[model samples]
Target: MEKHGAETYGELNADVYDEWHDIDPTDAVAFLAQLVEEGPAGPVLELAVGTGRVTIPLAAEGIDLRGVDASEAMVARMRAKPGGDRIPVTIGDMADVDPGTDDRFAMVFVVFSTFFFLMTQEEQVRCFANAARRLLPGGRFVLECPTPDVARYDREQRVEAHQVGVDHVRLTTVRHDPVGQRFLGQHVLITNNGIRLAPAFMRYAWPSELDLMARLAGLESVGRWGGWRGEPFTGEGNYVTVYEKPATPAS
Candidate 1:
């Protein structure tokens, strides 16, 4: 993958990003609803809310929600959705956040493995700290990432294409130097009247590495899961970590 790949992805895939982004939209809502009820309530902030898969649904439940995304194109797509305009969304880097206003949330979340885009340990830790500052004391922060099952991946760079119906999805998974991880993304909806592609680039993180980041941000892990349904976490499973900001300093 080129250095500018992620910057160009949103513009390149805007159209299909609207069409197929919520492949499992309903099930996702069900899970988020469960999260809302089981965890904190009231105001919530959604990080990297690409096209509002979880935010829009959660907003419909009448929860006070604000969304943040780095992509203008993706934000635009979210605006066209059923409850889009009802929520306020900011456009900015997920790592830096949109940089200010004193509002906080009961919960802050990064979904669909969005956390990996930070690409560095420092940036990932910074994001946790930023989210912590945006929460009320004792608020929860949740992040989901695909476990870095480096074995299922290949060492060499590759460009592969997949299709969901007439929508053709192309992917480019390039292995970066230093022998650590891979970049995998799909370009969807190619055969329609003009094609739109959604390119996702993720640098997988081991569960232990992420736990440390959360710890440094003054957040502690309360739970880890294999999926959105809250399955137990493991080496081969996906990760859903729930961390809470201590009511006072960690000391």
Candidate 2:
């Protein structure tokens, strides 16, 4: 297995990320905009805000939002986009850096399985703690991640062709470790010119584990949905969860 960290994904995929992973942001943007509008009074922060996919759009909608990303390469791409420069951004590890002592957000969010990029239980817990510390009392931390599906692996490994075109083909290969709840995978893109590989590692947590992490960070589970549209979660493949810090005055 190759050794890498949070920045690896952006470093490898930044150039082609927006082009290859483009998804209509209308629904997600609308959902999050409403959340921010209804929540406490403060700016919003997004972790791993690569290419400003969701962040840029939200900012356009008049949300006061800031972003933090580990990769300068990714941040640069976001900076080049229109209105991207208006949104404050920090280049640091989301799990460890303080956005600002004076700045507190009403909402913090990690979307599109970015939570799994932390790659270990310890890092993930620290991420939750960091989010909590950056939020105002009664603030919300929202995470969107795919529910673990070990069944997709056969003999602990699986490979599937993701895309096929006349000049290019994309394939995904994954190796799972049940005990550690980790998925080590690589995306292979083969073109007429050559081949490119983008590797990824994730330490997945069960819903119960997520709840415990939130509790440790002084947050309580407030909502869980199967999708961004507020569909009820029923052990689905992907889900969104919201955790809120208590509004009670600190003793």
Candidate 3:
């Protein structure tokens, strides 16, 4: 897949994007903790934890934390942060990741849009299989991906604009190719001083496709929600899925 050889956007604009979406982990601590209650501050693995957006804060929670991302540039950028030094991160593809030997995690997570980075259906399934392999018996794998049917793009074009700081604002327009089902186009970061355009692209998978992948990985979906707040998995609600490893059966 192109994702393997492609330059990651996070690595390129780490500094700029981090400044914009500096979500407080403390704010979502309760939410994430609720998702992986079984993990209980045990080994927690975060996949594609770029720029420490969630890993930094999760580490602060005092849990055993490990993160992995495909882009070394992004990993290096994350390492440069205040708490980033503390989190052990591996630079490699999320699919078929091995965090450590003899240290399987109680919970594995792929947050934000990280799941979409896998451009191919097979690779996405492989990622699930890999996560399952890294989990302890009865451990849980939590995932968050936007429901594919939420909004269909006629030609697939949308713009997102947000203020990064007092004077800087980033405007991104995602253009999808209907034929190839690939994300493409340009993201323009405009400031009072000037404007910089960065090209962006990705491939997105449907929720059903993800389900098949999880099933092939020996995971069963036990929970679904709209948002982190535990909203019902309506067609409109974002897809939040929980897959569990089979518990060691009593002898």
* lDDT assessment of candidate 1: 0.71
Candidate 2 — worst ten consecutive residues by lDDT sum? 93-102
lDDT of 3 by residue, 161-210 (tens): 75477887778777766555567656687778898876555667767777
Off by over 4 Å in 3: 1-7, 24-27, 40-42, 100-102, 149-152, 159-169, 191-195, 248-251
lDDT of 1 at 228: 73
Q: What are the Cα lDDT values of the candidates? A: 0.71, 0.88, 0.73
In model 1, which regions exceed 4 Å deviation?
A: 1-7, 18-21, 27-31, 34-42, 158-160, 164-173, 176-199
Which digits, one per residue and each the tens of the lDDT, describe model 1 over residues 123-199? Answer: 77788889887777778888877766445445544555444454444444445433445465655445556754456
* Model 3, C-alpha of 102: deviation from truth (Å): 4.2
- Measured against the true structure, the TM-scores of the candidates, in listed sequence, are 0.83, 0.95, 0.83
Per-residue lDDT of 136-234 in model 2, one digit per residue for the tens?
988999999899989989999999998999999999999999998999889899999999998878889999999999999989899899988999999
Please say which candidate is ahead in lDDT: 2 or 3.
Answer: 2
| True-structure Cα RMSD, model 1 | 3.3
The list of candidate 2 runs beyond 4 A from truth reads: 249-251
Compared with the true structure, model 2 gives a TM-score of 0.95
Model 2 CA lDDT for position 69: 91
Clashing pairs in 2: none
